[model samples]
Target: DAGVTQSPTHLIKTRGQHVTLRCSPISGHKSVSWYQQVLGQGPQFIFQYYEKEERGRGNFPDRFSARQFPNYSSELNVNALLLGDSALYLCASSLGGGNTEAFFGQGTRLTVV
Candidate 1:
């Protein structure tokens, strides 16, 4: 079984720019969640999508948004990026949104200059 996968591995952007990070979930998974991990901090959930519907969201600003595709892949779009937005954008997948253990990708490290 293929595990969750993310793209770019690393990214660099400037303030006020936009960036999109990608993720592909494991097979048979229906829930995908986006998280941001700052240096030395735990991963903070940004959004959770299940069955192609928004299930839960985190405390991030509107600038942070995401969507899951029919194939269970996902994309995280960050608009007007800021220096504080520089972090490891992690994507996790689970069978459902309840309380299942999440499998994470290596992450796309985004650095906003």
Candidate 2:
């Protein structure tokens, strides 16, 4: 079965533009999380959308948001993008919320020019 999948593998956007990145979790997984990985830094947690409850979000600005669908897929949306937002956006899936083992996708690399 597929572990986790993300779309568009690569993207380019301009400052002030808005972009949406999509993710599909593994079969039967109910929780999805978004992370941003900048060069030379670790992955920073962005948002977690669970099947049954609200999990948590990172310290990102209001421009960042996400939603989980009934099918357990997810989308991360960023509005008014900035050059600082250029990074690898990762999606992870788990059996449930909290510290469960998460399976991650290769991620969508976003470049804000």
Candidate 3:
């Protein structure tokens, strides 16, 4: 049994570029969510998807998007990146939605210059 797993543990991108981060939730789980963590701050929820549909979104701009697949894997996509976008992108999965206990991945560290 494994927890949530994210891909490409680290990445570097330029401003105005696009980046796609991947995640695969634990077996038998249906809820997948994405979060952004900057140094000195807590993780901010970005998007949550359950059963392949988006259930919620955070205060982020339109440049952020995500989707869950039938198998419960997900991808977080960011367009028109900015320096502010540099942070650790975390993926979490739980048995259900909101406030439920979730398992998180190590996260993909993105740097935009």
Candidate 4:
């Protein structure tokens, strides 16, 4: 089975612009979650979706949002990007929500200038 994957291993954007990151989860998986990891810090959960419905969200601003698709893939969108938004955008997937173990992808490194 294919594992979770993220596109554009790295990205460079200017402040005030918007960016979108993509993800594809493993086969048979129905849950996808997004996280942000700043330098030297653990990943912070951003959003989680199961069966195309939002299941959980973390302490992030409205500028950060995401959605899961029927095929179990997902996309994270960040608007009005700021320099602080520069970080590793991670995509994780699990069998289902709750206490399930999640698999992470390589991540998209976003750099805002």
Please report, as a residue range, the 10-residue window in candidate 2 with the lowest summed lDDT.
48-57
Colliding residue pairs in candidate 4: none
The alpha-carbon lDDT assigned to residue 14 of candidate 2 equals 99
Model 1 global lDDT (CA atoms, 0 to 1): 0.92
Q: Rank the candidates by lDDT, best first.
A: 3, 2, 4, 1
Please give the CA lDDT of all the candidate structures. 0.92, 0.94, 0.94, 0.93
- Candidate 2 lDDT over residue span 10-71, tens digit each: 99999999999999999999999999999999999999999935599899999998999889
Question: What tens-digit string does per-residue lDDT give for candidate 1 at 25-89?
Answer: 99998999999999899999899999899999999999988998999899999999999999999
lDDT of 3 by residue, 6-60 (tens): 9989999999999999999989888999999999999999999988989999999
Give RMSD to native, each candidate: 0.8, 1.0, 0.7, 0.8
Worst 10 residues of 3 by lDDT: 94-103
Which candidate, 3 or 4, has the higher lDDT? 3
Which portions of model 3 show Cα errors greater than 4 Å? none
| lDDT score of residue 55 within candidate 3 | 93
Instruction: List clashing residue pairs in candidate 2.
Output: none
Q: After superposition, how far is residue 101 of candidate 1 from its true place, in Å?
A: 1.5
Residues 13-113, model 4: lDDT tens digits: 99999999999998888989999999999999999999999998999999998988778899999999999999999999898887368999999999999
**Count: clashes, candidate 1:** 0
